[model samples]
Target: MSGVTAGVLDEAIKKAAIAWVSVEDGPAYALWCMPAENSIVVVSGPGEQYAPGLAEATRATVRLRGDHGGLILVVDAVVDRLEPGGDEWNELAPQLATKRLNASGTADDLAARWAGSGCAVVRLTPAADSVVGAPDLPADSAAQPPRETPARVETRRPFRLHRVRKR
Candidate 1:
């Protein structure tokens, strides 16, 4: 649907990681990284139902990559998606009153919950960093072996020549 391929996914994951690391506070919750032969998939779902689906997708991608010895990184964020009107909200209110915030805890809880939901469960063999990157051969890899050109054969047919004097 998103025209996502293995290379695209890997690039996306790298971008997300770069962005996440750039933030002063870092990501609020864990991020999923799945690498494939030609791409990688990165999913960011911080809420209840959404997180599970995203995690599952990430795990599946990782599994696929693993078959080819790809690499994946799952960064666990320690926060949970707060339900609009759930018991957790009530607890959060009291903690807010006490000036005790659990941003990391909240994220970790969500990650743990998603993990328990049977999401992000994939056994993949990690690949070297070099394996992940542009699919094109490096420009300096060496001039491409000279390509062989097919020989061309000429076939001539005889034609009668007629000479006409100007009238």
Candidate 2:
């Protein structure tokens, strides 16, 4: 696999629909996010799924996937919260909500509620030259790769089928 570069990472962030993220060495989880000018914007709180405390997080790691399954971009991030109804939230909320394009009328309401005291909009900015490259595979990663299974071969005639009565 080729090592990730700044441009490649940015492009992956732009094209990816969801990201696997974690903060402060916490368990990694999937989150829906949007790529902003210089950072990735993620939302979490009471109503959202995988709500990590990004506001209080100092460090974060985000993994973005490409169209192909094996294309992964891993970046170390700095997590921060955008002020409720502030410039950053206002700018990114619409972009973030684009993922739920079929929400119809409910999107605005959801956005408003998320912008309220209940939820938080977190920005995960890529740290300066902090690209955490592809993860090293364990020794057993390919232990089961495409090996033939041993099986007994039946040389007798095909077994007869018995038809059961309809209940």
Candidate 3:
């Protein structure tokens, strides 16, 4: 890959808080990840962000946004799952837990929970040569309709303060 493409990929992945991953032509799922040693690490499953098929997927498409919040880099990633108590997992899980926003417990606590709770920590190594950026971006928007969900806001009565009228 050229230096320019590499720079774009690095900048996009480092600056974005979330990445959109698609497996087997499925809908892109937005997942939180931490960039590590030229790869992205993501924790998924119950009690974490949903990334169906990613645990077993061998390859995936990863899209990242630029500083302006637009799709900046699209690349193919080689997926590899890490063993729960393996060296790589042990090294990365704590670090990723620390970076997890709105986490309820300490990094060690979360990592331990993940170890026992069937959470999968997968690495996404970008295929540097497959990166698409800049002038090579597709012309049409890739937006998709929202998926169905059971969640909805309930209507409620509003409360207001009562005041005496001046004469």
Candidate 4:
């Protein structure tokens, strides 16, 4: 069952690690992305990542999860919203703050706080020419897949301290 070109969907959206982002009607986010030149730069609001349609979405559906998370590439994007000192935010906010993860700051202080405020930098670009996907509604919840892998330890038994006799 091959055929998923465009360099295997841009090498599975640059070896995914987080990009569940689904919009065109909201809800379905996981952000923390960066792999432009074909688009996939992300970032949302508050504390970081909540992707509620970056100031009027254009279209989206990028799910690229793998590395045990399964689902490898399901793009169909074309959304843009990179305001913050333009020029593609001076070239993708320091490569999306060096593909942040534990960053807390640095990478030019997260491209200067996402070019100084509001935190957006969205850009998906993948609509057709491959990566066929554009159906909608996939903010999946209640996912099940853990039937048990051996690792349980709860012996229980320890709690005795009753003292109150003097009124």
- For residues 1-167, write the lDDT of model 4, one tens digit per residue: 12465776767777765777767755566666878776678877766777776647788777776567666557668888887877888877887888787988678788787656777777788865546422332456435554444686668977769865888
Model 4, runs deviating above 4 Å:
1-18, 21-31, 34-38, 42-61, 64-90, 93-95, 98-105, 109-124, 128-142, 146-160, 163-167
Poorly placed runs, candidate 3 (over 4 Å): 1-4, 152-167
- lDDT values, one for every candidate: 0.33, 0.70, 0.88, 0.70
Ranking by lDDT: 3, 2, 4, 1
Residue pairs with backbone atoms closer than 3 Å in model 4 (clashes): none
Among these predictions, the greatest TM-score belongs to 3
Cα lDDT of model 3 by residue, 34-90, tens digit: 988788999998899999999999999999987788887789999999897889988
Q: What TM value does model 1 have?
A: 0.21
Better of 1 and 3 by lDDT: 3
lDDT of 1 by residue, 1-167 (tens): 12234454454444432211111222222334333233332323333212334333212212222233332232222223333235643443233223213334654464454344443322122232323333432335322354445775567876759865788
Each candidate structure's TM-score, on Cα atoms with residue i matched to residue i, is 0.21, 0.71, 0.87, 0.28
Candidate 3's clash total is 0
lDDT, residue 136, model 1: 35
Candidate 2: stretches off by over 4 Å: 101-106, 134-167
Choose 1 or 4, whichever is better by TM-score.
Answer: 4
